[model samples]
Target: MENRRFDIRKSLLRALFASLCGVSANAMATEQYPCKPAPDEGRFAWGRIQSIDPNYLVKRILGPYTFKIPYGYMIGRPTPERLNCYPKQNRLEFAFWMPDFRAPKKDMWSEPNYRVHEPGRDAPGPQEYVVDVVGLEFIETKAGKSGSPGRRFVNGLALLRKDFRIEETYGLIHVVPGQNTPLSDDYVSLSNEGYEILLECSRPESRDSNPSCKAYLYFTDLQLEAVMQFPADALPEWQKIKDGVRILVERWIVKEKPT
Candidate 1:
């Protein structure tokens, strides 16, 4: 009886140790790739404050899709007037810092000097990119029945041209016909809201040695329209940047295992 009791205590100790080790492993994994789990339906619906982690990998459910947004990406906070929460069907606005971009330790989303670029004072600041994802319903409102992705893209270009007065203004257009013509299919050069924007209608064929443009892309693969804004100088490596953004979006999606 005494030997049996000793064996039972040994087994219990082994089980406890194993459990603690498993927990430690999980904690380490979380530290390496910290991600906030999906919020409950009630919390999402009520626009309640969920986790307070600065490096939040928010999980959002929109229609048929579930997105697990990674860290360095800022999720749109819900407001009293505009409750931009989960299970949303219309539009969602989010922003992300490029992988190379170094974000602040805290309040990265609301940092005042995020866009400031003052050489000598400090290191070069990375550009901030904003993206807007809209559903078919929102697209229908913008462009009528023939609101195909191609059509919407064309319309966007037309709107930008008209609004920026590209024809009327000189030097507004960055490309100089034969001098600095971009390798990309289409490039729009204009300044809006204090930022010089270089819009790309489609992917580029090759990288330019002295590419003089940022990037704005319209993606329709998510069953929703996604409009992206990034620094224009990155245009030379547009394909890589495009791929990176696509990868980020793809990673966010929670894939289901085969049954």
Candidate 2:
């Protein structure tokens, strides 16, 4: 009887310990992103404007977002990072991660070996081009401007052309200028519904060297108020989504750095 009682006590203690561990993990996960820790939900606001670092840039909340560039830094852009409509709020608090420009040699960039497309999803089908973090900036409309025009950008995770498929999608991007060029006073509108970013691989201008692997970015915004510089390296499935615009991609951003 005493042994059974002791066993019951041990089981209860184990359950309690597990519960405590789970709670601790939950707390840590929530606290990780706050600019500062808070007992409850934390709020993020606009802060400082940071310069650009060629090596590094912004990363998604849970992303395998790492770049080939040697170094990088996050910048605080002008737009709000999170804009919610429940309360009809448009908060523009942008930020970025950049490299240490001062140390040139220390900043080394490398290109990873990735196929143009994944094994299962071949070309002709929808391809995905993901990045660590991408943003759209709105260029101001001048006096002569009229209705807004849009731009298009795309990033490809894998690009499969006629010949052998490119294993790792690198610098694979495509950009389509808006209907109205910079010459127009009124061009600026990433807010458009059709605006998108895509990723694909194409034969480089020169067949001699390594096939020109690129990341294509298309912006539907009339005036690109946002300027996004992607990391040279990315994960297999790193993606971004905008609920307002209703844009989705197969490529995705990983929650953590790649192995």
Candidate 3:
């Protein structure tokens, strides 16, 4: 009888431990996105932005989907004063910042003499790139019969071509300016990577614009789209940037186990 009573107690203890663990996990999950939703304002309902640690895991939920972003990334509005928030017109927008693999240097000499004297020291070091990711819950009205994410991507490309008069010839994409296109004469040239490319600079006529490229990509896996702005000079490294962005999105999505 004593042995049987001890076994029962052990089983109870195991159940109690499991329950505690489950509660702890749930608490952590709730803490991921600590913003509180406010009443509807205009078209969007603002969420109170909190002073969160940069290393904190951020979470975003849309309909039946949920995304959990790991540490070393940042997400927020364009400006703190901006009242725009999610669930606006069935779309969500946010800025994401991640480390650039090409720019691994975090520290550098600040002395002007050192910079001037050292060869290749005056050259600028790569900095973290910010990408705007927009989540669309509904299919675009113009993207007719975009049954799959891939079709949606094609539709996006078509729209860009129609609006900007982009021409792809001999393995190169030439951005030909249209009547309303805010592009200079061949200001943006890109090799097609299956993503929409645009000018990243504010002034397309300036010399700085030549080296920058703004790319829009549709993520089929996540059923979302992202706009990445990076130096066009690093066109050769487009594959790395694309892969990194994919990994970032993949990390955010929560995978469900088969029942």
Candidate 4:
């Protein structure tokens, strides 16, 4: 395993950006971006926050969802250190564990020294990306611009791609442009850490005007299901993950396979 301290630039950049300017009361306006954490049921864009992190940017992808999040926060353990809350009502919870950003690829998710894993129905995917947390302004997620996140607000994505050592970028760690991208037929794929994670979305089959199922998320590692519904008291913390995935149908990339 590569030492976490191998990256010196990220630390230096954090120190440099911390002095630029503090967020003001006007920039803290709630109406700037109307982002209420509720399921739109189908595809849509999540609100954006102009976090003060210069090295970080908008646009993280997971399965059918693509939304802006604070940079440097990797797919953490299923237990979220920060945004952790839910009511008993048809609640949904999601957690992702990102692999160390540049661990050499050697089929760790399949034939590790301790265990031999299988992809089950889906094939193994590219290794995942991970990062450590320090001075992140991502916590102050305020109102953001509506509609598809424009390139201007999402400026940090390019920096991440240039600064980080990424391989086979997938899901939240891999920041792809646009919401809809071409994907494999399989909804599940393996990641770098030798664990099976849900990688794609298969539209639910239904003919009725209103389908019987509501969107729910699965924690691939724990094999736990969070059944979600729009309760009266649902908070942003509860609906963040579902909103990310639910919005994918409205917009996506649909990339072509390499020749």
lDDT of 3 by residue, 125-170 (tens): 3444434343334223245522243443344455453455656532
- What TM-score quantifies how close candidate 3 is to the native fold? 0.48
Error of 4 at 40 (Å): 2.1
Candidate 4 residue-wise lDDT at 174: 29
lDDT of 4 by residue, 1-259 (tens): 2455656767777866764432342234222333345442322311111122312322333333333342322222111111212211122222222221221122122221211132342232333211111111111112542211123123434433333332332242323334443221112223323222222222233233322212224433222233322211112122243433333212222321122
- Alpha-carbon local distance difference test for all models: 0.43, 0.29, 0.43, 0.27
**TM-score, structure 4 vs. true:** 0.17
**Highest TM-score: which candidate?**
3
Runs in model 4 deviating more than 4 A are 1-21, 25-32, 36-39, 45-98, 101-259
lDDT-based ranking: 3, 1, 2, 4
- Weakest lDDT window of 10 consecutive positions for candidate 4: 131-140
TM-scores for all predictions: 0.42, 0.24, 0.48, 0.17
- Give the Å error, residue 51, model 4: 16
Query: Per-residue lDDT for 1-259 in model 2, tens only?
Result: 9999999999999999999997786455334332332232233322211123333323333222221111222222221222111111121112222221122211112222222233354431223222222343332345443222222221111122223222223222223223322211111223336443343223233332332222223333332222232322321222332221112212222232333
